[model samples]
Target: MAGPKSGAYAIAAVPLLFIGTLLGFVIVGDEDSCVSTVAAGVSVTIDPGSVPQTEIAGYGHEQLVNAAHVIQAGKDEGLTVRDQTIGVMTAMGESSLRNIDYGDWETGGVINPDGSRTTSIGLFQQQDGWGTREERLDPYVTSTKFFQEMIQKVPDRDSLEPTIVAHRTQVNADPYHYERYWAPAVQIVEGLTGAQTGLGGASPAVCGGSLVPGEISAAGWALPNTGPVTSPYGPRIHPIYGTLRFHAGIDLAAGCDAPIWSIQDGVVVGRGFDRGGNGYIKIDHGAGIASRYLHMYDSGMFVNVGDKVTAGQQIGLEGSSGESTGCHLHFEVHINGDTVDPDLFMRQVGVPLG
Candidate 1:
């Protein structure tokens, strides 16, 4: 009987001891253990700081640092995120964010390949006339120079398409070359700053908080049509006219009468027929961002010139009303009156248009 009782008491004491050990560990632990289990059961969230240095995927640390410099330089000059994005996009298109000492006809500050240095160097690959070799190589100076030139040359740069603005400032041979880099540039800026680019509208976290007028929503955007793109936005031979022409917008082949939706919230600015007789509707999405829907059936417009529309709201129906061989929607995105590739513009705003 005594042995049995003693055994039972030991068993009970063992559990108590184990519980005490756990409690002790919880209340007081060595540095390592404490750190490991300090908040094991509690949720912990860390908000990013201003100018957060979060690593951008597929980018080296050096590239990220240089990108940060561009953003900071833009801010220093009181430029908006749009301007900073333009500078970064230009850098990406020119040098992939590297400050090379060589150019088209030169290498390592010396002429190579018999006139290979085209006098373009630095993060922006600025020409020799931009400044001295040293200044061009300096990321800050080059970015500042680029921004100042953009301001001086393109006074309405902020309202213009990023690639167009970059083209005007750089005088590059290809106007749309930098267009493809807009999405990456936006990602880099967001990754570094932990803030939305305000391309479509204010980010959800900062919505309704001192938003700049004409700022696109950072929350998200909508795809006007998910159908296969019949004709992409760019230079191409017109199917109907049989002439080389610039396709200002993308063509989505959604059978006739397919609903065409507004990409973002905005007031309808214009609704009329183009010279080609294609019925169209234009929405001013603020922030100098406007979307146009063309080739709607001549049945009339769903929203009027003064009507305010919301994202995903049906604005019209797709049709081959103007200059069309078949039924489709010709969607155009205009920034400050310059037509940009609708597909690229959609991708930049986080809504990829295929």
Candidate 2:
């Protein structure tokens, strides 16, 4: 298995959409292009601290605060702190990084302003018609796959063109296209979550204060009663989308109501449901890293938002909820919003996968 920096991985980029009559096109050969010149020419400036009043309208401040813990995991995984900025930027750009329920207006076979039918789908607006449906919607799977592909392109932090190419080949094919917007995107991520980039000259921290939600600490590894690890982090069959997305966390086959254990000591910052995340918990450990427990039994959640917890504590029971096939824990590790292998982080902390 290659580390996160290896970009040898190739997965489908989110298929493009016309959005409105604003779409323009160019024909390379026999194929009629449906890309917009405005999209091609326009530079996207992301103010990391500025939340779209129209977008993310319903989420409470606490909900956004809790989600930041998961974002910080990207940093812990050894990615540049900018990876967190880019990840959140990608989220904002892709699905506004929002876990949405409604489908594209053209979801079931509708045409775009360019007369092309919108077949691609989801929060990042990934398309199943272009890539496998299973790969598109799984967040960890898609995110890891995206990072793997992007890392191949980024020779260094300064050259993110390859990474952008891996994710949005059509819109980002020109190297300089996204350059103007990259800093803004980074600013948006850092500003929103209160995470420090440690990068010089970044805008002031907006949401200053970490909101790590559950208990996480360095200690001995006691596998949850959830059973043998059927799917360790990295590419796996996504139960919900029916495609291949990177599994950021481990999944163990277990019965519903099984006791879920905390790997370390921390605080509970988020717990709730709707789509995508289903039932989840986030634990924050100082040092800009955090752990996540997702898709568990809602009825069995022991802690709530803002509760502090210790190592090996019970935060929630395992179950099959929102976007899951069976009862299992979708475990994840994030440092600065970049997802890294939790297993690697675990071993570093003296806990073996065994």
Candidate 3:
């Protein structure tokens, strides 16, 4: 938990019978932001004066309050923290988290081919087709409308990257338009909720409710990334080399920049480019056991050689930097400095990967 949020707002355990005074220590995460459930048809009213932080993610009180409203709408819709983060990310990309009455047309943008200006407004800058002007201007209503549309447009949202899902929902010109705002939106949502929400994408190997996606297993080891195994360890045809080569590691379908965690507490023994300039990091975890992550770009590397890292700590972002065709995580488990089947070893350690 974030521990005793003493900045501006006070969070309470309003959902339970007995409310605790301790801050940031709760079962359902930050209660100050979630007022009531949407199934109850209770309107989430955001009073800008009550917003605690003067700024978060470079946004002032007004913008942050609008974010809270967006989050509140997500909550009302029974969405997860990941979904909430995406909602906020989309809003930030569209309007800088501000509920502006003006839209692209007013600013000489998004001109229609028919010589007419498209009308978009509100925090999401949604077109007039979304709702009436007054409804579009209302943060909660606009956000809810956005969420409803997203649910219909992207039914497989959980399996996709946040920006891709947002793009599909918004139908914006560029798919990666909202990419830069994703990290900031994740920071804002996690800061407000005290919950670990951003897992890069909703990878399937969720062990349990108690464990975050990557931070599973009790034996000082966790899954590096929850993405499913796209390629298994064995002799296989190399995609780039176009020759049958002994595939050394398992490839996960993690997309670009997905946070990859360390599977066990260890010291970084080596980190560099392979013969093909594929970025890799090898960690020695003692007992002749080691692990390595490959294909991360130089910028994606978050640790240096000789640095001690703990299990579940993020080591790098997923990338396709070498002789690879696409973005993926090449993970290898080692025994006595020799490569082993990561899927088998991970399963033996309580965290299984496909």
Candidate 4:
């Protein structure tokens, strides 16, 4: 929730590999050639007026032009660069940045799959009710409509996940559908605007040197609790139940009343006691990634379900409030829906668990 002026946010030197081949771009001052570094320590330059077609590579000239309109609309509306990126990302998911006149239909725009012609159109594929056909087809008009609805639906627009904000506007069947385009959207936005949008929140001044415990991995994750992994994630005998069962989370031995920080920026989805009577908090970090912190002290949660939390922000105090035998923090990570090994997931992201 910290603003750029707070000095809490900084551009981490995280590689743009998530954006794939899009990283091989240079700033071109003229139409003839390109240059490597735009400024000292800054590899990309901001040319908001034009799209980096060479950088984006695969996108056609029309797609790039439509994307530029969306970005320009966000700027005209006085929205943040993050909001503009979300707009571009939504277009990517809805129509691949192309204004199509047909949807849910076979080739040649006939033979409906469900015996119907979907009126979804434009760069966002907005349905017929969204606007008139002429207006829907206009990039600026459609982008304005999308941004206006997004501003109305999302309270803290800048802090919410980009896909969540887009979903609120598009009302897509899959809320996470726009997630895959996020990294590319960000890269495009930065490549064209030169604004380094941090991970929706503040970054640690130094990876491991911040007052917050644990080092921030290159993938932008931090340990939820600063303690050794006492209970590894997997099948194990339940300490309290005295039966063998699948342990869904890894327990960090943090003793009583230890601070629990969020591993990444996300919206708090669930909080309170589970059926087993364990106090817990769940956060949706987008891209189908979610994290949960369990067995917190009865002081309840520091954040509500709808609140947005940044990485390393304390959300609760660790305790033995669940079916736990000792005070510790039980943390879990989920991709899509299936729970995965927390240690392996963390290590894969460049943060090793002790």
The runs of at least 3 residues in candidate 3 whose Cα sits more than 4 Å from the true structure, single-residue gaps closed, are 1-49, 113-115, 193-354
> Candidate 1, which segments miss by more than 4 Å at Cα?
1-54, 107-117, 200-206, 209-354
Cα lDDT tens digits, model 3, 157-199, are: 6445566778778877777677788878866765554443323
**Model 4 deviation from the true structure expressed as Cα RMSD, one decimal place:** 14.3
Candidates 2 and 4 compared: the better one by TM-score is 4
lDDT of 4 by residue, 53-91 (tens): 464635666677787788878767767656777888988
TM-score for each predicted model, relative to the true structure = 0.46, 0.38, 0.53, 0.48
Off by over 4 Å in 2: 1-226
TM-score of 2: 0.38
How many clashing residue pairs appear in each of the predictions shown?
13, 41, 0, 0
As a TM-score, model 3 comes out at: 0.53
Best by TM-score: 3
* Model 3: ten consecutive residues of lowest lDDT: 1-10
lDDT of 1 by residue, 68-116 (tens): 7787677667676667778888888888888787664444343423444
What lDDT does each candidate get? 0.64, 0.47, 0.69, 0.66
State the lDDT of candidate 2 residue by residue for 28-75, as single tens digits.
111122111111111122222343343132344433432243244343
List candidate 4 segments past 4 Å from native.
1-49, 106-116, 156-160, 200-354
